[model samples]
Target: MTSLTLALDAMGGDHGPLVTVPAALQALKSNPSLKIILIGNQADIDPLISHADSTVLNRIERIHTTEIVTMGDRPVHALRTRKNSSMRLALEQVRDGKAAACISAGNTGALMAMSKVLLKTLPGIDRPALVSCLPTVSGKPVYLLDLGANVACDSETLFQFAVMGSVLCEAINKNPTPKVALLNVGIEEIKGNDQVQQAGQILQHTEQLNYIGFVEGDEIYTGNVDVIVCDGFVGNITLKTSEGIAKLLVHQLKRGLNSGFFVRFLSKLISPRIQAVLSKMNPDHYNGASLIGLRGIVVKSHGNADEAAYLQAINLAATEAKRRLPEMINDRLESILLDINS
Candidate 1:
């Protein structure tokens, strides 16, 4: 099997090389066939590599650049001004076919903007969607799309998201005909606005789409649907709210367990089970969000992600690369368009 190569934006996130270098090392250790190209200032990256094992260090390569894209940098400004920055350079590797995928913990807006411009959108896709895996009650993940990529969308865009999301679920989850749904106020047909309702009509008529009508916010984690499509404004708010609740639940559990001797003893008795539950719900495990519908693969890690979270993001990119995700999306998209035209 050919080894997979991923480009990393070493100087893009909150901690920059401090978090990314360690994460890259961990990912390399986990997958012996994996090669990583770290793009950033060599002055900062070399010292971090010096501490790694020689065996691991041999598989790593570096592309140096002094410029960095700040977290506050505007997407347009970064595109025009910071072309040589780590994030842009890493993405360029993907466009040039030097890397199968690119992973970055940088400005979300800037990353999407640069990727769309460089990698370009796939045929039949109007815009790329920010997609991520969310844990469900059935021990499988449900794919959610448009997580703050485009704030507003038309009915056609929503239909395209459903197609892209369905392909993603099939690729990642190995489901042949994944169940797709539209996120709305309620499960009824008349719950959403004109755009959503119109999108629903299109999905219902599209051939081979396993669309199951509307899904409410409460049903997201029920494992009832394989893909959930929504506008970016709604999707972003939903994703952030879910993250907040997961953190709160974990914090409250820890606090309640440490209160008094009786509780502490009970916690020790059930700590393993509690830990298992918390681990499944941890946002760190689901840190990578794919910018779907682009010609090349790009996984976006949370800006504040630590070593473990960042490693998960790298793993996500590698998995997608090995699966040939772009090809799968293109095939499925062509089928969807053909159905529409027929």
Candidate 2:
């Protein structure tokens, strides 16, 4: 059995326990060996568990909390005022080693705030990272770091993100020595502004990673880069823009197909391919973001997430628990520092 039990925030997100509870049940079906400690009112959670299949619901246990962190509440206040809120209590479990990781879709700001205070960053890592996977052209995906949790990041933070992200690719995605790249406006080392240029130069010289040269913004989906590093400001903007573009393309494609009978015929001909493409585009497939470099695994889901989104987050938490993600990254970083000193 996996030694790590995942702490689930049963009262987070726009839908609260109603959305998260079903996702937890779905996760139990898919991942039998995984154990879950649900953080919410025992009455609320117990009813949902009873509603699930007898065999599967047996895997989950309620931790019993009564308060919740709403999406609009101040994160700091939620932690202090609602000490028993599902979000805060779940993380506290992870911090106390009662759980291996914590998963939430609650007040995003609160989750970020509470995680930093509870989990703390790993040694030598400047700041923790919020990483997500974006689709690449090669049918594979690229891991993008610092998507939105923190706005400002330095070279040292980016470096640690690289180390942690590389480990994520290896452990979660099962890629050994994943290829990493620093995101920049241009491919040339001399072309980007101060931060990009400096990170590129530093990454180019980094012996600890299989660091590739600069990756252009357009090349992110080429499947050419396994890991893309950048500051949170840039990364968040890029993530939103990419999502916007995806939506725009889908809308335009639909409009163009419905324009006329002839075009509609072509669309029907390509309908099978189109359906396949749309299926691949569902955001639920990559719904979880790792709050990497923290002491415990903390998976972040979309605030307005549906059951599928929470299901993805639960599966991600499951995977991280199985991998014991932090220990692996810490061991790798320690080895690198030791090698550098020697």
**Candidate 2 structure quality by residue, lDDT tens digits, 1-342:** 544478999988788788888888877777767678889988777777776777777778788878888777886787678777899899998999888889998777788888988889888776788999877779888999989777887776777788888989999889887999888878776776676676666666668789987888898889988999888999999988877888899899888898899999888998899978976786666798889988889999887889988888988887888888999999999987776667
- lDDT for each residue of candidate 1 in 49-148, tens digit (9 for 90 to 100): 8988877998998999999889899999999999899999999999999999999999999999999999999998999999999988887788888999
In Å, residue 314's CA in model 2 sits off its true spot by 1.1
- TM-score, predicted candidate 1 vs. hidden true structure: 0.94
TM-scores, each model vs. reference: 0.94, 0.93
Tell me, by lDDT, which candidate is best. Answer: 1
How many clashes in each structure? 0, 1
Cα-based lDDT at residue 99, candidate 1: 98
The models' CA-based lDDT, in order, is 0.93, 0.84
Which candidate comes out best when scored by TM-score?
Answer: 1
Weakest 10 consecutive residues, lDDT, candidate 2? 196-205
